[model samples]
Target: MIEIFTDGASSGNPGPGGYGVILKAGKYYKELAEGFRKTTNNRMELLAVIKGLEALKKPGNEVTIYSDSKYVVDAVEKKWVFGWLNKGFAGKKNSDLWLRFLQVYKLHQVKFVWVKGHAGHPENERCDQLAVKAGQDRQRHQIDTVFEQEANKL
Candidate 1:
């Protein structure tokens, strides 16, 4: 079984943002994080989960994900994402990321647990710190092309 703790933070809405992910399996542990020059909190949150799942080396593992993002948790837990997938993600905000999520998601048995942000959960707090620091670290930032293109459309 594997446990994943994730968090995403933004310096401002649609501003500098990043995601932090902690993946643990038995005695092995890994931390993953990356920053984007422009993105929303929700996008970062979703990307955190995506990146974590993408890192899995093998399929069929039992994975438990802990996150504070209602946008990501509720959509998956409530079965809303399935409906969106069926309809080709019509009218969806982050269809690209959602599609990416479903691709990796199907490879494992996954569960999501929603936890309160800034609460004292050790791993969660660590993820939050990683996310915030990454967001503010200009040298580590990369362009979020999907977000940038969407913003151009508006």
Candidate 2:
């Protein structure tokens, strides 16, 4: 089985944001992280999971994801994403990310486990640290084009 721990952070609700991911399979491990110049915490949260899944080298693996975001955990655990997909993601925020998630999601048997953030969970805390550092590193942050475009539309 593969275990993944993920976290996201933002300086402001819709400000600079980033995600951190830790993937482990037996003794093999990998970390993924990136920052977005303008994005939401929820977007970063969901993106962390997506990035983790995308990093998997094999298909049809048994995977479990640990996250602190109820927004992301509940959406997948409660099966809301399927409904959203059925309706073509109408009235949804982050449709781009959600769609990207679905594409990578189908390649594995995935489960989500929710944990309390900042509760001293070692891996989760490390992920949170990575996320915050990435978010605050302005020089390395990349544009969140979809978010920027949506803001421009308003």
TM-score of 1: 0.98
Which pairs of residues clash in candidate 1, taking residues 3 or more apart in a chain or in different chains? none
Which digits, one per residue and each the tens of the lDDT, describe model 1 over residues 1-99? 999999999988989999999999999999999999999999999999999999999999899999999999999999999999999899999999999
Per-prediction TM-score to the true structure, in the order listed: 0.98, 0.98
Off by over 4 Å in 2: none
Against the unseen true structure, what C-alpha lDDT does each candidate score?
Answer: 0.95, 0.95
TM-score between model 2 and native: 0.98
lDDT by residue (tens digit), candidate 2, 1-154: 9999999999999999899999998999888889989999999999999999999888999999999999999999999999999999999999999999999999999999999999999999999988998999999999999889998999
